[model samples]
Target: EAGVAQSPRYKIIEKRQSVAFWCNPISGHATLYWYQQILGQGPKLLIQFQNNGVVDDSQLPKDRFSAERLKGVDSTLKIQPAKLEDSAVYLCASTGTSGVHEQYFGPGTRLTVT
Candidate 1:
């Protein structure tokens, strides 16, 4: 069984630029999530999706951050007019809702806002 998948392991851009990340979850997983991890801090949930529908995104910055799960499978996260504070790692995870919600994380995309 494969874990989650993410693209562009690393990225660097000047502040105010836009950036996007991609993710593909493991097969059979029913839920997917996007998280932002700042250095020295635990990951913060940015959004969650159950199949192709959005389940949660209250923590996501509506001004510049957006995400979507397509056909209940692949997902994408985008940040426009990114600020310097947006420099962090974007992680993707997936899990089944059968009893445990133990999520499997992907190799995250590291974004550097200069």
Candidate 2:
């Protein structure tokens, strides 16, 4: 099966600018998740989706970050009016429902704010 796919493996943007990232999860996976990982820290869950409906987004910063999983498949995450601290790795992961719930992750989009 194909692993998760993401574009622009690296990005650089200035503060207060807007940037968007895209993701394509593995086919047949029932659950998908997006996470933000800062340097020297573990990935933090930003949003999670089960099919087309969102299961959790408690950690997402609603003021500047927004995400969606339309058609219960592909997903996109956007950061508008970005801040210096917003620089980090945005990861997209997926898991199949029939087995262990461990997730498979993409190489991630690394954003650097200047």
Q: Each prediction's TM-score against the native? A: 0.96, 0.96
RMSD of each: 0.9, 0.8
Per-residue lDDT of candidate 1, residues 11-105 (tens digit): 99999899999999999888999999999999999999999998999999999999988789999999999999999999999998699768899
Local accuracy of candidate 2 as per-residue lDDT tens digits, 1-114? 789998779999999999999999999887889999999999999999998789999999999999988889989999998999999999999997786779999999999989
Q: Can you tell me which runs of candidate 2 are displaced by over 4 Å?
A: none
- Model 1 CA lDDT for position 69: 82
Instruction: Report lDDT (Cα) of residue 5, candidate 1.
Output: 91
Give all candidates' CA lDDT scores. Answer: 0.94, 0.93
**Residue ranges of candidate 1 with Cα displaced over 4 Å:** none
